[model samples]
Structure formats: structure tokens, C-alpha cells
Target: MTDSVALWFRTYHTAPAPRLRLVCFPHAGGAPTAYWSWARELPEDIEVLSACYPGRQDRLGDPYAPSVHAMADEIAAALAVLAADGVPLALFGHSMGSVVAHEVTLRLGAEHGVRPVRLFVSGSEAPHRREREESAAADDADFLAELRQLGHSSLADMDPGLLELVLPSIRGDNGWD
Candidate 1:
């Protein structure tokens, strides 16, 4: 709803005069489209912008983010434009997104002199404590198995064709051979 940099974000819905803007960061092995339903259901006073990562959906050909820090920095720059518009901003993230949101918040202050009013982080460790899960997939088969075990029934039910589409991004996120 703003400018050229909007390309990195997907707006499933928007408000003309929102009390606050919420940017949703997708989890690893996930994409912005998953948050599509949220835009329609949230309060009218809240605007929703789901950040879309590269190498997925409309950015199928685009390269995946090289690292979480790099991705967060890029997202911070995009959010800067929205901040400039005088809208109160907030970030909501789950799992990997939680960490990305934190990093983005920090970058916004240090790099852009902007700060979000609230940062809601869920399903993530504290900033001072970080731990790596042993999800290093040895192969595609292993990666798919991990997803199924992760209790994502959707992954268990995914069609092979669709699975093919999403697996690479997941693997890339996992950073395993």
C-alpha cells in the first residue's frame, strides 16, 4: 500500500487509517501466504503486512536469504519506509521469525534510527540464550521426515508436487546438504 519496496511484503488486507501496523514474519520453511487468512480476521484498526522471503512463491527464481542476519537487515530497510509514514509499528514473529523480528528491530534502531512500539516474539528462545536444534537433514528424504515428525500434519499430507515446490526452500533454510 506504500511504495516499490512493497514487493518484499504481501498485504492480504489493509486499513486506511490503522492505529498500528503489524508485520508478520514467516517461520523457516514457511512463506507469507500462510498468513493470508490473518489479514481478513484482524481488527480493522490494525494493518497487516506479511513479509515474503525470496526463493518462494512469486520469488521462486529469486535466491534464498544467505543468512538470518542478512535477511533481517533487508527487512528492516523495507520497514523503514513504513516507519517514515508515521504509523506505529509492531512486529510479530514465531520460531525463526521471532529471531528475525528481534534482529530487525535492533537494526531499525541502530541503522535507521527507528524503533517499533512493540515486538512480540513467540516460540523462540531469549535473545541472550540461543540454541541450535539438530535438524541437519542429510538428504531430501531426511528433511521431509523431519517435517512429518515436527507434527506438521499438513506436511504429512502434502502432495509430492507441492512438496517438491516447498522442500528446496526448507532445505535451504536448514542449511544442510
Candidate 2:
């Protein structure tokens, strides 16, 4: 994989000769590690590539993407390199990731002349139906409440320092400061 692609994608397993590549995008404040198990669960002929957004995990020092469209543009450029390899790609995304994946799909087709074979989205509204209004929690307490409501109670048990680091990405993903 090219260095540029490596910056945005993480591969947990190496497929000897992949028939297809499945690129996964995680939810808001999610990391590439979320899809790490897919490499073990799916057929060996399918390589799994997960998006590793900035400001988390290995890219912790990088700034969070200014917007989802910006994130998609960068991801599309990186995936275009993989598309050039002739292996068919299938995208899977959950929650906020679904929007980013949708944008990347459009970019790959329009800018790179690459069309993914399949696109699977979960837990997100239709791209065109998304509202532009702010949806982020109003404050730390509200953010924690939202996380709990979404079944992310585990985050509540996280180290305070770690939670502090994560909140920014979550808020950023939801289009708030």
C-alpha cells in the first residue's frame, strides 16, 4: 500500500489474492480497530480495510477533519490508488461513517472513474436527507448522556483523561466544535 493510503486506511490481515476488498468506515469517534475482527471473520479472499480518521488511535496527533466532505475527499483519493489495482471494492459503513462513505463513493466515481461493486450502510439516514442543523450535545454532561443513550456506556467507565481526548472527535464528527 502507498504511504498516502496507509495514512487513511488500516489493514488487519493480508489476503494472498483477494477477490474483493471490503473497506469499512466506523461510527462517530470510532477507530479502525472497530473492524479489526472482520479480517478474521470474513472469507480469506476478501481483504478488509478500515478507515482510521484523524485525532484517534495511531493518528491521534492529527487534527480532526474539518467536515465530513473533507474527510470523504481525502479517503476517496486514498482509495483511488486501491481502485487502480483492479480489485473490486465494497464499502461498509455505520452511523456517521455511512455519510462519509457515501461521499467517498461519489468522489471515486466522478473523480477517479471508479465504481465500487457494493455499498452497505447502517445506522445512518439517507445522505440527501441529512439535516444541516447542529446535532452535537450541548455540553459535557449532555454529551455523556447522549453516549449512554446510544448504548456507549462503556465510555463512561473510561479513564477521565482518555474520555477528554475522545469527546472532541465525537463532537467534531457531529459538526460541533
Candidate 3:
């Protein structure tokens, strides 16, 4: 019965001299801080805005999306506000965020009439390419094992105590699907 809130995003102030902006979406169980270093690495002309979904880190009390669509909607709204300056945009997403970014890009194009100039997707394939299932609801042991198999640095390298601390929010959000 956890209440969900809007997703969070971080705007890294770049030179802002370019006509385009680049928005980055995080993978499942990821936070904005994951890409903090990316901002400094990107070209100065392409402003970088990294998305940080709720229910983790600073937003630990918020609820994560129960489905991919829900996650997309949350991201779209946040991006709408952050990218409202009318600059052309490009999207980059990895893993779970790739699908969310695709959905959001579609919504932004169809609903807001804001079409991104390009989409850079990694670590995930096209949406219709896979079956949708409640894979996250698998038992914790198996789920953790699966995450390990997926090569997530956070989960794989986490100390038991920190993993214990962070696991609930991940499990809660993952179980929703």
C-alpha cells in the first residue's frame, strides 16, 4: 500500500550553448547519482539531465512504479518540466531504463508533440522483442541471484549490510510487476 510519487531528475548545468539537450535514464534500481560523473564527461554543448526515479536514496520514502508504463509516465512528466525550454532533445537509456525511455519518448512525441532528435538505447532490446512478466516477484534469493547474473555492480559488489539496507525498496518496486 505504498503511495507513489513523481520521479526525480538532476539537471547538470552544461555550457548550454548547443541547440540540443541530452537526457539520460537510469536502469532499474538505479539512482541519479549513478551518472554524476557522466555529466562532466559529456560534451559541454550537450546539456545532460540524468533521471533519478523515486523510492531510492533521497526519495527513499517514495514508491516505485508497478509497471513499465507507470515508470514512463513519471519520467515524461519530469522531463517535460526539465526540458521545457524548447531545445531539441536526445534520449539515452540503459537496461530497464531503455524501455522506459522508449515509452516516454513515444508519449512525448504523441502527447506533447516533442520528438527527440535521436534515441540511444543500451542493455535492453525493443519492447515488443520480449514477453512481459512479473519476473521481479520471484523469491528474493532467486531474484538476487538473477541480479548477480545480470552483472549489476551495485548488487554484486555490495556489502551484506548495505545490500540489506537497500534491498527492501528494490524488492518492493520489483514485486509490483
> Evaluated with TM-score, which candidate comes out highest?
2
How many backbone clashes does every candidate have?
Answer: 0, 0, 0
lDDT of 1: 0.84
User: Where does candidate 2 have its weakest 10-residue lDDT segment?
Assistant: 130-139
The digit string of per-residue lDDT tens for model 1 on 1-177 reads 465357678887779888998999888778998788988888988988888888877888988888888888788888998788899899999988888899999999999999899999998799889876767678878777888888766887889999899888887777621
lDDT of 3 by residue, 1-177 (tens): 012212456766565476777788887777767777877887777777777776777777776667777777766766666557777889988887787789889988777777889999998868779556566435767888877776765687788898886787666546644
**TM-score for each predicted model, relative to the true structure:** 0.90, 0.91, 0.83
Runs with alpha carbons beyond 4 Å of true place in candidate 3: 1-7, 16-18, 136-139, 152-157
Q: Give the least accurate 10-residue stretch of model 3, judged by summed lDDT.
A: 1-10
lDDT of 2 at 90: 96
Clashes of 1: 0
Model 3, position 65: C-alpha lDDT score: 67
lDDT of 2 by residue, 21-94 (tens): 99999999999999999999999999999999998799999988988888888899999998887999999999
Clashing residue pairs for model 1: none
